[model samples]
Target: MALRVTFVLPVFPRAPVGGFRVVYEHANRLTALGCQVTVVHERWREGWSRPLRHLREAARDHRHRRAPHRAIDWLPVDPRVRLLIVPALTPAHLPSGDVVVATHWKTATLLPYLTPAHGSPVHLVQGYETWNVPDPAPVHQALRLPFPKITVSTHLTRVLSDLGVHSGQITTVPNGLDRTTYRPPPTGAPRAGVAFLLSDSAAKDSRTALAALHQVRAHHPALLARAFGVAPRPRDLPPWIHYAQGLTGEDLAAQVYRPSAVFLCSSTTEGWGFPAAEAMACGTAVVSTRNGGVEDFCHHNQNALLVEVGNPTAMANAIRRLLDDEPLRTRLSTAGLATTATMDWQQSTAALLTALKAIS
Candidate 1:
């Protein structure tokens, strides 16, 4: 018999952000594997005026069609995967299943109130999300809960262990890349330039990336700079920097990673830095700070160059070294390709299923 798996999500299904993408991929792949999967999402927020909210949702849907980055475009269509939209996440509103997953801290806190009739609760710890919220104590307490845990990286595994979770209670499943979509371009060498992600989040630290690029430009006056993100292009970005907003997965591979010589990441933290791995898979060398979770694959002076976070000068120096030394760049690029080759999504998904089966 197939296991009935349900994921309790805090937000309405939308564009695949780093965290949400993982949830979407798991739900989609599990359905393909013949599991009966259900994704439960909130349909409306409490205290919102229904008429006004409807109008706003209509406008947002129109905008999403024009630029999908504004919202989610890829949702599972398999008949085995069902979407249940409810008013809220109270115990009465959740559905019963063979296995139920709490995808975020808020949901994890509710697990104790639920019984096995709601299925066994599994905490999918994507990251140390307390950093983004105003009150972290609740999230911290949730970490110590007795639920079985699955972390996306070793950094998170360590974080949970530090929180006093027993090693036997947690499993680490690293993220994977779609090699067919991210492979190196078929032709000439990558163009001389640097590519990075742009975002408004404080943790992303896009300003530091800009500062680093500015420092590099002082030496290589004509060095190319490119950036892409889900958000619309910012007004303050330098005019010479090529910026593309709302690029799809295929567009990101073709327009940004495939042609860039180096991928620069300056994030203060990450569950798993997907862009860095994707760029590396496309044969672009990576220069990044010691962002958490990226440590899973980024080996300094091996597959990529690492620097201290929040230091523009160090980031600039690393970018320049890569630009000046063709041999070093080539070595890192080759090693990065090899690293990604081993990280197949099929393998990663199989590991996740194995864990879920044990729970069932």
Candidate 2:
């Protein structure tokens, strides 16, 4: 008999975010492996007056009017996978399945109410998401729910351990790279520029990255800079830096990583930093802060140049070092490519399936 698995998601963004992408990939791969996979999306609701709530929903809908309706539009989702859209997340809104997975802390908080109809839930801890919630006590309490936990990086595992989850209850499944899409360019001579991701979120620290880029430009005026993000282009961005909005994965690989001399990541924390790994897979050297997740694959002075968080001067120095020393850049790029070569979706998905089977 095929295993019936359902994943509960808080909201589906039009643009591809790292955490959502992981959930989509697992659903698609599990469907291909003959599991009955279903994705349930719950729209976020505000605890305001009905009139105000409707207005907020209308604004959100208008903002994403150009976005696609289904995951298949942007990602490679199997047709066999079923999608369920619900207005709100409640016990009555969910479907009973052999296994239920909560993709975020908000959903995890509701698992206790769900266990009677469904089964012991599986909490997929992608990051330390307490920072995003208004009342983190609920998120912390959810972490202690009697359920199996699967995390994406060593950093997340450590976080769960700190939250009092035993080592036996948590499983570590690292994120994988799509080798087909993110591989080295045909010829390895990249243009004289650097690339980084832009975001409005505080943790992404886009301002620090911009500051570091400004410092790099002071010394190397000829150098170019580019940024890609799902957010609207900020008016404060220097005219010299090229900005691209809502780029697809293929476009990002071709336009940003493949052509850039180096990729920069200034995130303060991550469950697993996908941009750095993807850039390295495209054979670009990376200069990133010690964002927890990147530590899994990024070895300082080997596969990447690591610096402390919020230090723009150190980030600028690392970027300058790579730009000036071609030999060092080549070594890091070569090593980075090798590091990601072994990380494939197939392997990671198989590991996930094994963990699921053990618990189920």
Q: Compare the candidates by TM-score and give the number of the best one.
A: 2
Predictions in order: lDDT: 0.84, 0.86
Candidate 1: regions farther than 4 A off: 44-71, 74-79
lDDT of 1 by residue, 258-324 (tens): 8899999999988788889899999999998898888889999999999999999999999999999
Ten residues in a row with the worst lDDT in model 1? 67-76
Give the TM-scores of the predictions, in the order they appear.
0.92, 0.93
Residue 208, candidate 2: C-alpha displacement in angstroms? 0.7
Whole-model lDDT, candidate 2?
Answer: 0.86
* Candidate 2 TM-score to native: 0.93
* Candidate 1 structure lDDT: 0.84
Clashing pairs in 2: none
